[model samples]
Target: MKFILGLGKILTIAFWGVVLFNQLLPQPVPFNLLINAVGVTVLGLHILEVLFFNASLRGRSHRWFDRLQILLTGIFHVMSIPRQPQLPRNG
Candidate 1:
């Protein structure tokens, strides 16, 4: 799973790079729209992952950076941060 997430991060960065390069060309490319659409979807998923799974980091002093890392690396960053242990519930 970590490997897959790492692959996703690389793909996301490459996709955005292609999108930006397409934008700078003299003529709009036929596949640019499709690439942009996929890029947006991937970006949205990353943002949502940070919002939901990584909410605990929001209270930290370097939260902005944490959020950014979550957005870029997804669960890979989440895995690196130490999580609090869950307390037992009494009946």
Candidate 2:
């Protein structure tokens, strides 16, 4: 699972790189708007992910950097954060 998440982070970073490079190329890339739209949509969703996972992010040593990684890598980053232990309910 860790390996998968690591691979996902690498792929996501590559996608971001392509999206950025596509903007700079003088020649029109095929599916240019599609790529741009997907990039924007993913970024927006990642921002929401940051908000949704706000509680998990509060106490970490590198909170801001973690949030930035969450912004870039989305769920791939989120999955890496250690989950808080659940308390037992005494009925």
Candidate 3:
């Protein structure tokens, strides 16, 4: 359980680190797209982490605060998505 939590925290930090580094460092368009793709992937991983924790909590060392945090983060994650923007086409 501790290991799982630690892994989750590391993944969360790594997601933010990539976002920060992408913003700070100059990069080619393709690299920028790659970073954006990674950001999306990390968000998905966070949701997965929350779900896994929810299931594993049943028979393991459990903390209400941790569960609450995971639930809230999951909610925020679901609510944060926006519809895709319309793209312009060449004439």
Candidate 2: clashing pairs of residues: none
The global C-alpha lDDT for each of the candidates, from Candidate 1 onward, is: 0.74, 0.91, 0.59
Among these predicted structures, which one has the highest lDDT?
A: 2
Those runs of model 2 whose alpha carbons end farther than 4 Å from true positions after fitting are 26-30, 87-91
lDDT of 2 by residue, 1-91 (tens): 9999999999999999998987887236557888888999999999999999988887789999999999999999999898878789999
Please rank every candidate by lDDT, starting with the best: 2, 1, 3
Task: Order the candidates by TM-score, highest first.
Answer: 2, 1, 3
**What local lDDT does model 3 show for residue 81?**
30
- What is the lDDT, from 0 to 100, of the residue 85 in candidate 3? 54
TM-score of 1: 0.64
RMSD (CA, Å), candidate 2 to true, equals 1.8
Best by TM-score: 2
Q: Report the lDDT of model 2 for residue 13.
A: 99
**Model 1 off-target regions past 4 Å?**
1-8, 26-28
Flag clash pairs in model 3. Answer: none
